[model samples]
Target: MAAGQPVVVLPENVKRYMGRDAQRMNILAGRIIAETVRSTLGPKGMDKMLVDDLGDIVVTNDGVTILKEMSVEHPAAKMLIEVAKTQEKEVGDGTTTAVVIAGELLRKAEELLDQNVHPTIVIKGYQLALEKVQEILKEIAVDVKADDKEMLKKIAMTSITGKGAEKAKEKLGDIIVEAVTAVVDENGKIDKDLIKVEKKEGTSVDETELIRGVVIDKERVNPQMPKKVENAKIALLNCPIEVKETETDAKISITDPSKMMEFIEQEEKMLKDMVDEIKASGANVVFCQKGIDDLAQHYLAKAGILAVRRVKKSDIEKLSKATGANIITNIKDLTAEDLGEAGLVSEEKVAGDAMIFVKECKHPKAVTILARGTTEHVVDEVARAIDDAIGVVACTIEDGKIVAGGGAAEIELAMRLRDYADTVSGREQLAVRGFADALEVIPRTLAENAGLDAIEMLVNLRAKHATEGNARYGLNVFSGEVEDMSENGVVEPLRVKTQAIQSATESSEMLLRIDDVIAAEKLSGKEAGGDMGGMGGMGGMGGMM
Candidate 1:
């Protein structure tokens, strides 16, 4: 290294954003993403119509869906997206709330930075606030039990009320509770995957029905087979009914037409024998996981047996659970004892598409909700809503705890956290107060989305929470009144709130700690011109994160 000579360190193409610039850029990007989905917050929240590059449109108020559909390119923005994704995966709801809180945390941290507060102090304050928030949440939470059917129903309805399925939420809530209850194990744990939501576009949302057994999006293999079978004896087969082809290619050397005819006859015999075995098993309805030979379909129809081929492996497993039928991989192994029984096996046309319905199972561990709507988009949204409802209900059962929604939980958290900040002595107390203020964004955003005076609503909400036993009181968007969320039947799983705060704080802390961003120069068609003017070469860097 020579004095007065510039040292060549990092590559010329690498882009480095250091110190305050890095933090500013990251916070700005995070705020932009937060603002993007901010409008889709509460019961009065509006839906976003996102159109992709191929012109495919998705109209949804779901936060995670909107974020995932958008082509987000900023690295820090993607981290915030991970917060929403984690929320969705953990609690199946509250993605928007998580992202919004994270954004507000970043915004507040930026203000603190401007005031000469170190990032470490802010991070420490957030961690303290997070711990206090969790303790306060447990204190404020209302306990729910697996047997509290009405409370569970309210939890489901709260999750569904803001989205596309609000009109049908009451019925959907009942269906969700029933489906989840049906699959609860002896240990009282609910597997959400056991409840399948099958959607179709044809009828109104109110017409959705719950099937005690599984529903397959497949019709009978042949139209000639019976459309409906009563007291169906279902045989679940994982193997194909078609003649097996030799794995190694071989020349048969059929020099004579008679010999070729004999070969064809042998193939027919094999197909007939497969059908005979199914008939001998006394299976009136066959759900095959593999392909069925055309000749075999003819024989099944002749035997008065309805067969559906190429069923998905997941559906097969679900059918076994729903119908109490053992899946037989080999045709020779099938018998009456290997068959599952259902009250009815029918092929019904929903939204102009044929689907197989296995209904009226006895003690089915898995079930399906046939969700119907008038349009493709409507059905899609209905499915999303149902999914959210199911997720919350399962969470409620698993944790056996819930809290008031409509921002009641957030308000309670904010109030208690501020009081908690008073006991602290250091500058970190300021950060704790900031964390409390950040949480108020939830109720504030709710009021803003509902066209109410945000300042007045926050003031009113705070005043209400200032009183004892008024913790459950929150802003009711419909009447623009602050009331008890529990009495209004607005409730959510406790996990939604706790997970949101945990995720937001952790993500904000991670972003605050990043004071430097080193990104490699991206290779693209336009940059091929070789113009490396300043930091312009780092433009449109989407994957650097």
Candidate 2:
């Protein structure tokens, strides 16, 4: 088995071993894990309130988040979680579906095994069933020919649902598609930082688009700062201020007019020295983190320098990348190329503050993927979904799109697998048939995780697809039978169609035929769940195969 060839499970012995309680524990553990995430599946799915030992609480309907947050003890449950993690990592969209389908598939196989069916026969039957289900899925899938505006919106909506931002979901989709579309290079791939969404303290629908770059809330302190600078060039510095101090311990006490005059003269001399040093450095655009005194600012201004005073410590860093200016804030002198160009000028009043967008820096971390909403919190959630969308989109763009995050489509594939499993012929046929039959439960498991009654939701999907061409009109499978996805859409992301099919096909074949769970290891005593006597707490291990 360790030689790396395909593993196979014979129908008779497979059943005999898994049918025993000890061996069955493996199956039991896997199924239980799958069921745990069943109720948190879709847009309509209810949320899970997970509380950790530290008493931290997370209320989320996101399947992956919930799974990662909760604690599961059973080793089999851990295996199921691993499967979900694989699915999620491979395809950002399908964690819930994988988990849910896996649970029910195990459940059905267990029942069939109890009814005297062998494991190998079920595995064979499921293999046969897989082709049919794939055929059905292909037939059912609506091919979106090219990226049209409407089609692009549909793509965004697919990621927006169950995200709790119903009103802004559709609108945000348009923004994503439109923003990304404009930035697509001649080579056809979107640039990484072209479309960005940042979190801000602003009301909803305050969206603005800029042909040139726009800064979110760039600021500078001091009235002596330049009102405007033409043809501004800037430098970005990563180093800290290394200015030579005039004195290590200098204190001023204004006890007399003579002392006051002396203090003023000393301060003026210090300021003059700082300004003269900066001017000598050759920067017309000076961005400073350390203090810029009034006398220094006046001197720099007189020297024809466009000095930006009191730049925030963080903005100094970010703007540095944009401006191409290296800082010697505390250092005596600087250079021209170090002061990057301050390209554009734009100002805004909203979210209760006057904000300026300074631009044309050499490099910016993220670009704004502007979206409009009606309120503050609404826009906040919209921003969150946008972040998730970015993660999903970026991941898909990187890896080949694997599968839907939710399990609806994959569960259907599993059902097809079970049907295929049923067609096998064997002396140990019954046990194998059990496995094949169990595959049918994948959809129900998905629905259960998403918080819907699996049976009822599947029926609705059938009814809708039969009558209408789309599943959007159908209820969400995870929650109780409910109305459509509302703002949700059923289309897949750009590259996942092939991947989803491939995963379904491969997992079905591997899972059904496997007779035993063997790990080549020195630690053998931890095998607590799988004994030949019977299954663990939940049910028989037949479905687990």
Clashing pairs in 1: none
Q: Which stretches of candidate 2 lie over 4 Å from their true place?
A: 1-23, 86-88, 112-147, 182-187, 190-196, 201-234, 241-366, 369-384, 391-489, 494-545
Per-prediction TM-score, please? 0.96, 0.59
Candidate 2: tens digits of C-alpha lDDT, residues 32-111: 56666666555655666777889877666555677777665444555566665665556555566556555655665566
Q: Predicted candidate 2: what Cα RMSD to the true structure?
A: 10.3
Q: Would you give me the overall lDDT of model 1?
A: 0.90
Model-by-model lDDT, in order?
Answer: 0.90, 0.52
Kindly state the number of residue pairs that clash in model 1. Answer: 0
Model 1 residue 70 lDDT score: 87
